[model samples]
Target: MRPDPEGLLPATEPVTLIDSDGAPVTPARAAVPPASELVAALGAMITARRFNDQAYALVRQGRLAVYPSSHGQEACQVAAARVLSDGDWLFPTYRDTAAVVARGVDPGQTLTLLSGEWHHGWDVATHRVAPLTTPLATQLPHAVGVAHAARLRGEDTVVLALCGDGGTSEGDFHEALNFAAVLRAPVVFLVQNNTFAISVPLSRQTAAPSLAHKGAGYGIPGQRVDGNDVAALLAVLGAAVDAARTGGGPQLVEAHTYRMQAHTNADDATRYRDDDEVAVWSRRDPVERLRTFLTRRGDVDEARLAAFADDAERLAARLRDELAADLRHDPSELFEHVYATPTPQLREQLAMLRDEATRDTPAGGSR
Candidate 1:
């Protein structure tokens, strides 16, 4: 028998396998994850959290141009990478450096976009990860198109597309869902509903009950999971990916998480949000929750957890060493990647900039 199309939705109350206090909750909506996966998730979240902290520090030290800290959302970021295979593609946004790094992209490479280097620091084709798209919801359609094309080519590939809460309101988000639903593309949309789209709260953003409910309108299944709970995210995202890989069509999984840091290092979250609210979410921190659970079950100990921290430190040291270098701008290189075929106007602007830069440079060619 066919399933009810409208019945495709997240289980009531959002799947929360592990509560904020690090205790396993009763009657979880999804299957309980194994000890191995749980430990792995804990390690990933720990590493990711440390890495995010380092990136934020880099931004402060001016080593990075900017950074969007996924401080409290490490579970969503790490689990997204954990569930997928190397053959799968991940469409990451500017805020998903932790996820990108977890997918085996070099930490230094992921920071390139934020560091104001090239469009993306690494080779997209090599890693099967797309560029860090900054524009909201633009990558949604791109991901859908790639998934559909892969289907046409008979490739066994699935695409995981991520966006923020703000992206849900975008027209591209709606269009992408419609296309994926109609085409049954092997793609999953993971919306990290981090409470706010910049300064706008979730309540002000939409009145549609929940973001996951948006999928109902497009004939796709939507599942809302506790973003801070790595176990639930892994279970739900794993199921979504498998279903899509088979013939179950696309899936939309919403992770109800929070952005512990400001939207970016450039913005001040304190101006809009009070300290109490942050404190409440801080207690629900994903990394702490997973670590607490694992430690309680004897799955992990402080020594092992410290090893993870050491690993994170090594990666951060590498990023610091790599990004700390002073880069010389070739004024001309800017116009090169802007277009495949340079526009006449761009060509004129490029020439003018080159002339100005050359004339302003020191005669000794030092400046």
Candidate 2:
């Protein structure tokens, strides 16, 4: 028999687990995974956290141009990825590298996307993971379109479009939500409510009390989850996925998490918020909280934790080496995908670009 759907949430309340100090707390409904799954989730979160920190260091040291740290948002990412099947599609934003990793995207390919080699890292046709979009909320429409196509073809797969809270303010967000509602498309609008968009606070983004409630305007189910709690994230995502696959249409989920680090390597959050605020959110670090929980429960040992740290360091080192050697892209490649068949206008533009390139080259210069 299928698990009782109502059991995922006993009431219309948010789910959570550990507090800032890593103490156990009663959530609306907390269902812990088995030991192996727990360890895997914990390890993945560790890997992502370590990778982001290393990337930040690299940026500061001038080895990288930009880095978006996923410090306190791992559960919001990994849990969503864990709930999806291999056939499902992921439309990720720049901040969802952890979700892409957990969704089975190769680290090398993901790094390649960020490394500037290619926009569409892998043949998403093969991996079922679309290229990460840097533009704020553009992926939402593509996700809804994919879901509509799947429904028309009678496929059981769903699409999860992960975006930030700030993305909801974009017109694409509203259009995608409205279209999905009209078509009853099987998609999950997973919004990671990190409480800030760059320097903009959530208070400035919307006057609505809850981001989840934004879905009601579009005629879909919506709920908010405590994004720091891995179990809660998983349970809520699983429920949302189940509802989607069962032809219940779309669901909007607002994951309440914090961006414990700056928005990007180029951002200085200190200008808007103080060190005390950072220190406060630092206490709610997702990785440390999970590690403490597992340790206290005797689910994972100190030796295992040490091994995880070693693995994360090794992965980060390997990624740096790989990315260092892969940082070139052809400007013409961007024009190649604008149309299935190049129109006269595109043809003229390409020809003009080639002529300029040829004219700029000195006689007998290296190609």
Candidate 3:
């Protein structure tokens, strides 16, 4: 594909459709998206934006201890999530809750996960979306393992692993890619380069030109795309997922995006990045870009956009209420899943703890 240098996308190079203003830019000419698809994409983008906003608010209010914001990277996530097949597995990081929601997990259930009420949120096995791994870059090897298992079982399932650019530095990243390549497992490693690992900039992450180039070392196909461009993100991920489903081994995709918000509720980005940098990224807001594109093309009118916003608000309110009513896990429940059968030492410890609790209680009181 030829690069469109005129379109100033967030990436170092541009190879996607629909610029930040929603102009339909082609290799030869610029145009617009189809009416129906454009409206749907617009609605999805709006809903996703609202979802991220509400999630951030909840984090600030202490409803959630910490949250990795997906404020600016929703396009890449939503597009990728939409491309998954039924049997495919998604290994997502902490910041990928949006993609998880798009892949069929309910936002309420996500709240449960983030709140630490559940260990395996949304039944990963049933949902085909694995539990969100907080540890950096660990899920890549797990995705490779899932792909290998599917192959052994004669199942045509692909594993799509999502991670941030900072995760690329881990030893597991290299190990997982090498193993997948050697075994020819069906997997797609989607790297969302938001240019920061918490407060650390991409300059400290790597000297490589792009994360895609890292795939060459593992002998896999490598590609880069404008992560903020919804249509282009969809097209690229669609092709990659199709290839994986059809027996293609693996591919590495570096999605160039920006983290418009802090890394998480606990982070303060201002200490590391200047206000000017944030302002630059704000101009490329994926949600606003798509909305502008849809409006300019007459694909979705203002009333329709308003309706989407209304629906998103209603959904967010419902999620807030539902999460409020869900039971918070008992602290003791933490030990429940630690073993299939308790070891002798663990059993003795539990017994001792139980006796101590009983002894400490008042004569007629139950503890």
* Best model number under TM-score: 1
Residue pairs clashing, model 1: none
Write model 3 residue lDDT over 254-326, tens digit each, in one string.
8989998988877888899999988888888888888887788777787898899998898689768766663
Query: Looking at candidate 3, what is the lDDT of residue 120?
Result: 45
TM-scores, one per candidate: 0.94, 0.88, 0.90
Better of 1 and 2 by lDDT: 1
List, residue by residue over 270-358, the lDDT tens digit for candidate 1. 88899999999999999889889999999998898888888888988998898888877877688887889888998999999989978
In model 2, residue pairs whose N, Cα or C atoms come closer than 3 Å (at least 3 residues apart or on different chains), thus clashing, are: none
Give the lowest summed-lDDT range of ten residues in model 1: 1-10
What residue runs in model 1 are displaced by over 4 Å at the alpha carbon?
1-3, 339-367
Ranked by TM-score from best down, the candidates are 1, 3, 2
Candidate No. with top lDDT:
1
Candidate 2's residue-wise lDDT over 1-367, tens digit each?
Answer: 3324443222355667566566667643556556677678889888888777776776776556677877789988788788889889888888887778777776656755555454657668877888889888998999999999999999999999999989999999999999998999999999999989999999999998688878877887788887887766777888899899999888888888999888997888989988887787777777888888888889899899999999888878876776666355555776787888878898888888888888999999965
lDDT values for all models: 0.90, 0.81, 0.80
- Between candidates 2 and 3, the one scoring higher on lDDT is 2
